[model samples]
Target chain A: SAVISQKPSRDICQRGTSLTIQCQVDSQVTMMFWYRQQPGQSLTLIATANQGSEATYESGFVIDKFPISRPNLTFSTLTVSNMSPEDSSIYLCSVDNGAFFGQGTRLTVV
Target chain B: DQQVKQNSPSLSVQEGRISILNCDYTNSMFDYFLWYKKYPAEGPTFLISISSIKDKNEDGRFTVFLNKSAKHLSLHIVPSQPGDSAVYFCAAIGSNYKLTFGKGTLLTVNP
Candidate 1:
């Protein structure tokens, strides 16, 4: 079992601003995943961050809006750029192929 | 297309009773299924999992039943307690290893 620590447990940001969420794993992992859960919606996979490589994003999401960086196996960061009201959602980071998850960062964009 | 479906939005059960939650999937490629429990202001926590080749898996008070032929699955909790009250999510993983989740069902185990 791996433990993940996510920063900024909750944040309220102004529209048009960007917020970066950081995820740190207790153990080194080859791949880490980012997810989003909007109000009253299911958890959606945003992107898969691979160590030493570019992150693979899912459909309906783009890199410019959610840029990811995985500098090492144990750490990664996701930046939500040009935020809007629609971007208000809970963001989470996962490891161990989805078995373990960080507490998640709840972002409210106004 | 919603590959995973949890038809019931919410369920209420008295404490110490049996609480059953159902889930269905449209994608045949999914080979692994998992259930997660989530409290408000927290991430979903892994509860139990079942493989496509298995029909059932049990862990203490929780059991997951898989019916591959019906493309359905369910989670059963015996002697449900108030602490179990939370949003439950059904997730599936295919060859791609990415989890497809269903809209969660809020379970309220009344004391």
Candidate 2:
């Protein structure tokens, strides 16, 4: 098991602005995934962060909107660009070996 | 296609009673299956899992049963506890490489 930490646990942001969320892991894990969960909804996979390479996004998501960066094995960052109300949701980071989540960053775009 | 599906959105069970959560997948290619539990304001946590080769896996009060032929799986928690009340997620990972998840089933344990 690994201990993952994510910053900006909860934030209220303005529309058209952007906020970058950071994730730090206690141990080096090969896989790091980003997920978004809207209120009363299920979790949707945004992308898979690979160290030193561009993140692999899921079908409905794009890099232009949700830019991701995995600079190293233990750290990654996700920037929600040009936020909107539709973007208001709980953003979580998970690692491999079953789903281990951080506290989660709740973003409320106004 | 909705590869993974948790038909029931919510389930209510009394404390000390048995709680059963069902999950089904449309994709026959799935080789690995797992269950995760989540609480509000927190990320989902790993619970139990059963691989394609195994029909059952158990841990403490939790047990997972897989019926590969029906493309279905279920998580059973004996003697439900207050802490076990949370959103439970069903996930599968086939040779395709990535794990696909179901919407999740909210289990409410009334004390």
Among all candidates shown, the one with the greatest DockQ: 1
Candidate 1 interface RMSD to the true structure:
0.9
For each candidate, report its DockQ versus the true two-chain complex: 0.79, 0.64
Candidate 1 Cα errors over 4 Å, as ranges: none
- Candidate 1: C-alpha RMSD to true structure equals 0.8
Q: What are the TM values for chain B, all candidates?
A: 0.99, 0.98
Backbone clashes in model 1, listed as residue pairs = none
Q: For this target, which candidate reaches the highest TM-score against the unseen true structure?
A: 1
**Cα-lDDT of candidate 1:** 0.96
TM-score of 2: 0.94
